[model samples]
Every structure is written in C-alpha cells, then in structure tokens.
Target: MIVSGKLLVSLSLLVLVFKVSHGQPLVPALIIFGDSVADVGNNNNRTTLVKANFPPYGRDFVNHQPTGRFCNGKLATDFTAEYLGFTSYPPAFLSQEATGMGILTGVNFASAASGYYNWTAQLWGAISLDQQLNYYNEYQSIVVNMVGEAEANAIFSGAIHLLSAGTSDFIQNYYINPFLRGYTPDQFSEILMRSYSSFIQKLYGLGARRIGVTNLPPIGCLPASITLFGSGSNQWNIKLNQDAILFNNKLNNTSQTLQKSLPGLKLVVFDIYQPLLDMITNPSDNGFFESRRACCGTGTFETSVLCNSRSVGTCNNATGYVFWDGFHPSEAANEVLAGDLLAQGIDLIS
Candidate 1:
C-alpha cells in the first residue's frame, strides 16, 4: 500500500510528538551558529551598531524585553527549539547564562552582521565565524570539566547544530563594498561555499553529527534591500534576489557533497527563500496585511537605532505585518518559517 506525502509527514509529526510527550527530547541540545537570524543575544554586549536590545524590537517578546534578537519577538530558531521540546532556548555564548549548568541545554554563537568571510564581520565589529568556532571549542572544554568526557560526548553527538548566514554577505558586503565588486556573483558564492565547507568539516571534527544550515532568504524583498538597491523604486530588487538564488543553489549542492564525503553526517539545508518569498508576494494568503513595508517606523528602511520607540509611524501591532524591521521578520512570520524549517529538518532529529 502506498501513502500520500502529506500523510507520511503527519505520521512523522505524530511520532515526534509522542517522543516529546514522553519526556524524551528529540535531541539532547539545540546548538546554533549563524548571523543575526539565529542570534539570541550574542551581540548585546558587543559595541556594534547591529544591536537590537531595545524597545519596539522585543515589544512582543516574553516580558516585553528586547533580548537583542532582530525580530519583534522570537526568531525562527526559537520556535524550532520549542518544537524540539527544549524548555529553554539556547543562551548566547557571550551571555552570563552560558556558564555552568546554564549551557546544559545548548548555547548560541551567532552574531549580527556576520558572514562566511571574516572581513565581512570585521567591517561591522561583529564576531567572525572562526571566532565563534573557537568559542564553541571553549564551551566543549567547560562541559567536559563539569560532566566528564563521556557525558559531554553524548551531548555533542546527539545535539542538533544549526548554522545560518550568507544573506549578510551579499546585502551588507558584496553588494555595497567597492573592493568586492571585482568578483562576480558566482565567484563570490564560490568563496562562501568554500568557507561553508570548511566550517562544516571543522564542526564534524568537534563531534557534531546532526547539522542544519539555513539557506539564503529572498534578499531582494527585504525592506532594507529594497531601500538600498531599489533605485528609488517601490519594487523588489530582482538582481539581489537572483544572487540569493545562486548562493542557495550552491549551498544545496555543497551540502550534498559534504554529506556524501563525511560519514554519519546528517547535513540538512533548510530553505527559507521560497517560504519567505511566498509571504512577501502573497501576504493575504499568509495572514499578513503588510508585505511591502515593515511594521517599524516608516517601514521602508528603518532598523536598529532608526527603528526605535520614538520612530514616527511605527505600527502599534506587528501581528498583521510580515516584517518587524527593515531586515528582520516579525514574530508572526517567524512562526510560519519555523514550521517549514521543522518539516524540512525532520531527519536531523529523527
């Protein structure tokens, strides 16, 4: 007997729910590394302009406290943690909560404005990918000291590691920097792929088996992207979107190769591009009222410091909007994206 794809998915979800309800989490931990999208509050203490630990940013979060997450509330990763049955979200590696028992669940090493290239992070004073890995190594040592090598290894091998980047590479660096203009989009994507491959190999060496990497979203549809590259037009920039597609394709292909080469590596490439693009192009279908502009300030291009409580015309409620700021999605949109991610990344936990 043959079963429909939808039915198979439903059955799988049922199994996951059964496991979680039995007090057995799908994974031991939810380790995260990436850019602002996955960052919980890694950049909060850093003297960088890419911070979001302020009002109007976390206005809808728990206790309405901005935790340096770029979104108005929880990020997609936060929802992923919930689905995986983790009672507490991973604390930022730089935060005080990263010490001792606080890191038993997991830790986030993501930084805002960071990319595959170290120079990209240097441009904005954000932590580089290399440095994030180094911190992870240190975290492993601390965990070993607390729980011995055997228990620590169990956590490392059983945990799900998530990596999210690339969007900032193009939007913040390649597209804007004059020095990087020499390399074509394809060449730049190749460079990023190399970095991605290296990062995965090093992570595997550190005993990470289950890995989920988020591909690029629709870069052209972002409020900040449109404002910066739209040439004063109220339309999404197709060029930047094409670049994102190119990079995502490379990411898919590279992930396949890495999985084939590395034994026991469960590398799943989470596609955020089409899901987010659908919401932007067909907002009504996704329960969103506004897609063209963000919910903050004028909605065209206000983020970070510009998207403050004092910003004029900031929307009172963000539930009806697809985006909370110029560069990040609202909590409502993040929920939808998270659902899609969990479905796509079922293998990571299974």
Candidate 2:
C-alpha cells in the first residue's frame, strides 16, 4: 500500500489528533492534596463535624447546588482547573464520580479541617495528611491500570499538584486545643514546617514534580479568629497573624531548598496572605462590601455546620463579602485568590 507524500502527511496529522484527543487534556491533570481550602467534598463522606455539604455553602455554584465545598461556590482548585481548561472540578477521590477518565485527569484528596499535622485532623475526625498521601498512591495505581504505566507516569509527572493547608494546624489545633499546649507559637510553626517539608519530598518521591503549595492566609483577619480571640487588646489575634507570616516565610524557603535539592522539581509557594489581607483590610478596593464579617449568620460566629440552612441572617449577597462563612472565603473571593495563584505560579508548570 504505497501512499503519496501528501496523503502520508495527512494520515500522520490525523493520527496525532486522535492520540492527543484520546490522551490527556490541555493540562495533563490536577492532583490536589491538603486541607479544607483545597477540599471539594472529601469531608462530606467522612464522619467529621467539619462537613459543609449543606445549604448556603454552594449557594452561588453552578445550579446553586451545595456540592460539599466549604465556600459559597467554587474553591480555588475549581477555578484553577477551569483556568487550565478542565470541564469540571476535580472530584473527591472517595466520590463515585472519581473513576476512569476522571481519575486519570485528576482527583482531590484534601479533607476539610485537615492539616500538615495528623493531630489537627484527628481532632476533627478529618482525613489526615498521611491518609491523603496514601490516597494519591491509590490514585496512581488506578491511573496506571486505566492508561498503562508509561502514559500514566507521564500524566503524573506533568500534572499540577495543588496543596493548601496549615490553617487548621494553627486555628483549629495549636491555638485553641489545650492538648497541644506545650509548644509555643514559634515551636508550633517549626513543627508544621517539618511535616510540610516531608509532604513535598514525599510527593516528589511519588513522581509529582509540578507542585503549588498555598501559604497560610492572614489568620488574624478571619471572622472566626476575630470572634474567638479579638476581644480585649487583640493580643492573641496579633500573635496568631505574626505566627502565620513567619510560617509562610519558612514555607517559601522550603520551596527554594526543595527545588535545589530535588532534581526536576518545580515547586511554587503561593503567597495568599498578602492578597487576602488586602481584601480584608481594604474591602472597598476589592469590590467587597463586608470584610470584618462573613456573609453567613452574624458573620463573626458562624462556620461549617453552624452556617446551616436554619442560620438566621445569612447575607443575600455572598459576592459582597470577603467570607462566605466565618472562616472560608466567599466564592467571589476564591476567584480573586485563584487568579493571583494562576498569575504567580503558572510559570512553575508552564
């Protein structure tokens, strides 16, 4: 079957198109791991009080359906996938939808209230960091079975692994829990760093080279933090914010160190604190009407389950507020933060 030169070229192009279409999408995949900030709905299936699969949570999402996200709509990861041209948000690894091509594309292993430290998740009955890492290993095996080893390895190496955590460690564990009381703020930050560094190294070992880890947001400004520790001179809140800054700095340093130490690694530390602080401190500048309080309930004392359907005084306009609940950012705020992340960290993957 001898073919002419033009016919041969046309056949080659057709084969290329078929291979690409049947293979990975624009951005190979987006494998997410970390805490509530990255969790899509992993916590909903868990036996944890940290679940947010209820009304007023995903109120602003497509179809206004609450899909267990902690925010009023999409999370940063959801926007990230969309920005990278994914048709849908990465499904939770535990969800039934996370199978075949979905698993091949990406999966979210993060759990609400989880953190770098397992103890933080244990406190709230959420999936721990160790467990999430195990889930990634599970995902790798599934993808290999679906697409074969060589192609699966390519997707794994090219994928963007988004990790967001440390909030629960500081707010839900070290700050409030008396059980972990011995460590001072500085010592606690170091503790979290050790785990964080290990997590990145472990991911690299698992073939994740393109990684973007979100730093701690300004914890002092969160409505929940303000309500819990903003009384009196706000010394506790001040201390917490300072701790958060210090930890973020350390995280940045860790990224640099890991990049140098690990071969073919592209790790970026997303500075969420500055952008989020700007939105909270200068709400009008960010087109947000409310910064000091959330849109749910009284805006200062409600979060997670507390920001439920029966919660009175839930704001009609989630877009006008910085936070949807006392702790989580509104969907509008997530979009802004996601934009910042894409701008700052796209190079790492590209």
Candidate 3:
C-alpha cells in the first residue's frame, strides 16, 4: 500500500486504547531487539563474535566491566526502562537463568550486532528479525507460565516492545546503491518500511500492543562515515549528514501507517533524528563541542578499523561530543536523546 494517502492518516488517529483501569496498576516489562543501539549484550561473547563486550565499550559500566552494550554507559533502552521505574538495564534473556530473574524484571533479547536483514552478520550471522521474533514468542510463553494472566496483563499493559535500528541497514546493504531491487531511493525505503510494518504487525499478532520504535540516526555524521567517506570535496556529504534525516522521515511516515494498520495497538515514536540533528546543527546548545570530528580515531574518520582497539583509539572527552565511537552515541547523547523522547510524554497504555 502507498503509505501517504489520507486514508492511512485518518486511521492512525482512530486509536482504540486498551483499558487497564480494572484495578490493576500498569508495570513495565521490556523486550528489546535490534542493532548495536538497543543491544544489552545478547551476543554472549562465547568467542570474539560480539561487539561492545570488549574494552572501553563499557568503561562507564559498573565496575568498569564490559557487558557488550554499544554505548559508553547505559543504552537508550536501558534508560527508557528506568524512566518507567523498572530495572535501568534489562537483563538479557540468555542470561536470565544465571540472574534468576523473571520476565517482569524486563528481559532484553537485543544483540549488539543483529539486524533485520539476513546479510548483516557475517560468518557468525547476526540475529534476523524473524529470529528475534521467535525469541519474543519464547519470552511470552515464559511470562504466561510465571505470573499467570492477571499480573501478566498488568506488566504486559506496560510491557513495551522497543526496536531501534537502521543506520546499519544503509551502511551494510541499502546504500550499496544497487539496482537489484530496481527501486529509487524513495521506492527502496518504502519497501523497507513495509517490511518493518509487517514485523511490527507480527508482534501485534503475538500480543505486543505497545511499542516504542525509532528510525536510523544520522548515518553521515558517524565518525566511521567521516573518517572514510567525509574527506571528499563534498564536505556536506561527509560532515553534514542528511541520509539519516531522510531515512527517519520515511520511518516516521511508516510508524503513522503502522498505527493505523492495527487496532488497539499503541505505537510511540522515538525520534532519534532531531536530537542528533540539534546536536550537529546546534552543538553548543547541548554542550557538544566536537561536532564534525570523532572522539576516537586513528588515520581518518576513526574508521571502524580504528575503533577495534582501545589502546590506539581513545577519544579526548566523550561528553564534549555526541558520538561515542564512530557509529554509536556517547552516554551523554543517549541520555539526552532518550530524555527528550520521554519528555515527549510516553506512558503506559491504559
């Protein structure tokens, strides 16, 4: 379906809210799945197959131990749960047995390096969206077994499905500028948004009625992009990124369409665009000094190659900038952006 027609627009505003006023207080339980942005270390690091579990990745984490999360501190998903009074960082589903926790405490199935496309992960093969959905199904079964229907509804009422990814899709595949899809930039994005809508619908079918979703952040602003792609005469292409803005605009439209596609589903948007947009566009307003350059680097854009080793690539000051590594955000950026999203007034569905 073409996404921008007035029919879809009218339907999205016709939301049928689920009633939680039957004497049960809504409690938050989170299930997250996506790329490095939302990953709370689901990769397991059984071998060296994961990112974020290594040094400097979690330097700000408790005890300075690496938990494989992409940010210097808690990810947006972690802080998002905390905003609702659940655990700040959702425990990984794979580690639940060791932690001895129930789903009500919030289980994170998000892997640091996973994506919706099959090609994202190389030899190790990253988690596909379908795989992530399978895990979600498993978690739902666990929830049903644990607290029974009553409390399940309470927690599930507040239970929010958080999916944050996309910058990878472009860098990894979409922006290869291939003709295999036979689509213009807008056409390709429409296909992606539709796939994403289907993914969300699948979750809704399985009973995830509340969701917080985000679009790709500014891909051109990433250190990796600049270190490699930014040095060209087109500094605007290199330094001032607009690819993410375009992708996010498409994503916002898609979210609006998805809200209309399903009845009784609450779709809350997390705008990763303007927050970083503000940072790059107006760096001083948010205390971000180094806007165009990277905190970590080696020869050029601190290309992903340089970011691998902490010994060589540490940045000057993380808080002075928005990006942490080349691709992800600093703790400050995550906090500020996530804080802005909350201020947009996300609450439990009632």
Candidate 4:
C-alpha cells in the first residue's frame, strides 16, 4: 500500500516496459499527427530547418540522446502511450525502429513546423497532413502484411488517433507572412477548420474511429511569440491570443458536429488552451519558475535548431522551466500537460 518514491518509479518503469514489450495493449495503438508540439522525430531525416536532432534538446531523455523531439524529454504523446499501457514511446513511422511488431505499438507521423495546411509544411519542408495521410496508407499495407487483414482492421478501428496541428498555420504563416496577412483571424481560422475537417473525414475513411485532437495552446504566451510579438503596448499579443481562443471555439464546435454526423466516430477535442494558459498565468502553481523564457539559448528567440548544442546560455536545469526552447514546452511542463490530457480524454479511448 505504501511504496517509496524510488521504488514506485522503478515499478512503474518495469510495468511500462512489460506493457510495451509484451501483452495486448489496452488500446491497440496510437497514431499521432501534428506539428512540433506532438512531433517525436518524423522531421529528423526530412530536409527541414524545423528540426531538433542535436544536443540540449533531448538532454533529459533516455540515454541523454536527442531523438528530434522539440523538448528536453518525452512529449505528451509519449506519456499518453504510457498511460495507455505502452512500454516504450511510439516510434516515428519514418524511423527504422518502427518495423515488425514495433508497428503494433504505434507510429508518430507528426512533423515539426508542419500544420493543417500543406503550405505550412512546405514553408519548412516538413511533412504535410496530406503526406501524413499518405504515410498512413502505406502503414496500412505494412500492418496487413504483419498481421492478417481481419486483425489489422480490428487494430486500426480500435486504435486511438491523436492529432494536434493548426498552431503553425497562425504562428509561422498567417501572422508573419505578407501573403497570408490579408486574411482576418476569423477567415484564417475557417480555412484551418476546412483542413481539419478534411483530415478527420479522411481518417474516418481509413477506419479510424476514436480520435483525440488538441486545440491550440495560448500562442501569445509562448516564449518565441512573446519575444517576436510582445512589446510595451501588448496590443499585438492580445490580438494573437484572441485568435487562438476563436480558433479553439471553432475546433470544439466542428469536432462535436463531426462526431454526431460521422458514423461510429468518437472525436474529442483536448483542451490544451486553458491548462497551458493557467501555467503561463501562474507558473508557480505548476512547479515552474520561468514562464516567459526557455532554458536554451537566449530564452527568447532561439528554437528548433537555433537552440543548438553550441548555444552558450543553455540552462543547467530544465525542470523549473516551463519551456525548453522559445517555441516548445520543457519536459517538466509536458508532464503536467500530458497528465491533464490523459485524465480528460482517457474515456474516449479506454
């Protein structure tokens, strides 16, 4: 009944390894689709500037090796798989580790800096949602070969599909690009929603039933956003934050409508906005000391490869910071967020 802290951690890791290495998982698998926030390592081999494959990035990960995650450690998707009884993190579909029975554990198709729009991925040469779907189609063939048709179909239908995109459409494109700057926030959100709906229906067609999609986190509070858009007036920052709220609202409504209209679909919008806002507004409440700066580089503008191994000012300790780089949450922050997500959306899959 009373387990020591060290022992508890040991037991948990052992159980996780067992679940990942053996037994039928609670959920057959998890397929992740998103931008940097949920990307594991799908961008590593791609000709993308939006990559995190070098040191200080995965400083706290297993073996202290960088695996292209935009964080100091495991992502929320990895933790979600842990809760779902996975022994190890899901492998990126493009990674060599994703072969054989490892494919049954799941695969991550999320590419950093990519988004709902194909142009978003093109901006950084990352994989677009369309490309991710194509990869999924290829994955289907792999699954059918590994297991019979009936079993493969059952695994896919029972599996949980996780999606998180759209942030880059606003952050990296609409807000900055002169061409996209013509559209109002509402108009841009609509465009993104059109893309989201298309992706969902496409997954549904591919036999996916349970899907968990994360809404945008508070973009205004991201260290990079604050550095790029923050000023004494704070007017521009307020506007971006408002756009995020508007986009999240539309996402909720669309998910609800789609779930009702699409047969056997269970689409749940994970509310990442509120919890992240809470952590930003009150960092101490979530065990974070630095809320507006990252642990790497200048803690303001550096992200992706910019927060490199040669970055002179990378912090010695990352646990007290909410962000690892200017653009992404630190491992500590990810753990808190992932715990909330698993609690909120567990029923949809389990």
**By summed lDDT, which 10 consecutive residues of candidate 3 come out lowest?**
16-25
Give the best candidate by TM-score.
1
lDDT-sorted candidate list, best first: 1, 4, 2, 3
Better of 1 and 3 by lDDT: 1
Residue-wise lDDT of candidate 1 within 95-125, one digit each (tens)? 9778778697799999999999888899998
TM-score of each: 0.98, 0.91, 0.82, 0.92
Residue-wise lDDT of candidate 3 within 271-317, one digit each (tens)?
77767878877888898886766555542344222465554657755
Sort all candidates by TM-score, best to worst: 1, 4, 2, 3
lDDT agreement with native, every candidate: 0.92, 0.86, 0.65, 0.87
For 1-350, candidate 2 gives per-residue lDDT tens digits of 88996675556545544554575445688889988888888888778889888998888888998888898898988988876767777899988878767677789999999998889998899999989999899889888988899999899899999999999998898888887789887788888889998998999999998999999999988888988988844333877789898898888887899899999999889999999999988889989988887899998869888999999999898989999888989989999998778677645545
Clashes of each: 0, 0, 4, 2
Q: After superposing candidate 1 on the true structure, give the runs of residues whose Cα lies further than 4 Å from its correct spot.
A: none
Q: Report the lDDT tens digits of candidate 4 across residue range 1-350.
A: 98896675556556655665676667888888889998888889988789888998898999999999999998888888887777788788998888878887689999998898889899889999999999999999999999989999998999999998988999998888999878899998999999999999999999999999999988988888887888754222877789999999999999988998999998889998889888888999998888877899889879987899899888999999988898898889889988778666745654
In model 1, how large is the Cα lDDT of residue 214? 94
How far residue 15's Cα lies from its native spot in candidate 3, in Å, is: 24
The 10-residue segment with the lowest total lDDT in model 2: 12-21
